[model samples]
Target: MQRSKLVSQILEKKNYLCVGLDTDTEKLPAHLKNKPDGIFEFNKRIIDATLEHCVSYKINTAFYESMGTKGWEIMQETFNYIPDSHFKIADAKRGDIGNTSHQYAIAFYETLKADAVTVAPYMGEDSIKPFLSYKDKWAIVLGLTSNAGSKDFQQLILSDTGKPLYETVLETVAKWGNIDNTMFVTGATKADFFEDIRSVVPEHFLLVPGVGAQGGSLSEVSKKGANKDIGLLINASRAIIYASGGEDFDLAASEAAKEICNEMKGYIV
Candidate 1:
């Protein structure tokens, strides 16, 4: 999807929620566990139920990859079910050298047909540049992630730069691709630092996780991170998708998503 079109969708919907499809087979409803295509069936319902409340869908590849070939097939089927009007993201977090990275890009962008794929920037420019080369597609590099382990390296203060490594990352990576094709995975748990991060890459979009189940504040992230175009994709996974374990799971998910959308409407510019 083009950057302009994504922005248009956000404005048109009055929200920027991105539902995370981190479906776990073991955690699926009891009835679905016995089905031949349980995972895909669960995903189809979640997508259908929440479609009206979100402008994007992010599929965490690990969940699908775990089931092996059948899982991969289910992942592709779920991707196909998502409407093109909303941005599709494959949360693969893949990063490697030039040739290897090119194949990863092809797997997500060409094979899976995702509009964006999360990437790790620890390997530096070459590992990330290939994804940026694709027009209208995005390379979502990890900046300040929400994981507890992020403090181990991402927040380290480098002697040479005298700044948290993540700040340098935000500044350096922003130069590799324009605001149109580049986005940073700035965790919602780091809302306090959004103002500082925004100073580094004000125009680039930020894929924010941790808002719901992780206890990150939506209003705080919006107040500090949003630009004139509302450059944020706040994702809620377990909190929405697993809102219920019974037959009403789809309705529960829809209600959870709608609640978030309502909060987002107040924050949208």
Candidate 2:
């Protein structure tokens, strides 16, 4: 997925919504839970229902990885099911030393064929550089995450820089890769910091989680986080995918996604 193609899709769709397939097997519709391929079935339905409303789909690997080999197969199948017209992301949050990170990159970018993979940056440039080596693939580094625990470290003001650690992260990490292959994960819950985030990397795309189920205000993020290309992949997982727990789950998911997409249309300008 080229940066230009992603922006073109966003503009054409009038929404930057990135539906997250954070499909929890325990939370699947009662009817589908007992089936052999229930997880993939759920994902297939969700992808089919919401295809028109979003420009991307983020498949959170944790949910699948927990299922072991079967889960990995399902994850790969789900990735294959997604249309190439939309950006596909593997939310693995993986990072390690150089050689290890290369393997992680291969797992997500090569094996799973995802357009992007979410990565942790605690290990510094070596941990993140491998993911950026692929031409059009992206490494979505954690900037200021939506999780509450993010406060413990990301917000700490550095003695040398006189700026929050996340700010320093944004400044330094932005230099490691160009906008085409680099993006930052700034949680929608951390909406307050979006303005400051943009000040450092205005042109890079942002993978924004915590929007729907996490209670982050979409409007606030849109107003503060959007770039010239509307560079925000606003992800709504449980809110949309698990909208209903019955036979009508697909329809419910479609409506849920459509509603968010509609709200997004208003913020596009």
Q: Which ten-residue region of model 1 has the weakest summed lDDT?
A: 260-269
1-269: candidate 2 lDDT, tens digit per residue: 99999999999889899999999989999999999999999999999999999999999998998999999999999999999999999999999999999999999999999999999989999999999999999999999999999999999999998999998988898999999999999999988889999999999999999988898999999999998999999999999998998989999999999999999999987
lDDT (tens digit, per residue) of candidate 1 on 1-269: 99999999999999899999999998899999989998899999999999999999999999998999999999999989999999999999999998999999999999999999999999999999999999899999999999899999999999998999999999999998999999999999989999899999989999999998898999899999999999999999999999999989999999999999999988874
lDDT of each: 0.95, 0.94
Mark the regions of model 2 whose C-alpha exceeds 4 Å error after superposition. none
Q: Please, what is the TM-score per model? A: 0.99, 0.99
Q: Give candidate 2's error at residue 17 in angstroms.
A: 0.4
Pick the lDDT winner: 1
Report the lDDT of model 1 for residue 247. Answer: 85
Please state the error at residue 109 of candidate 1 in Å: 0.4
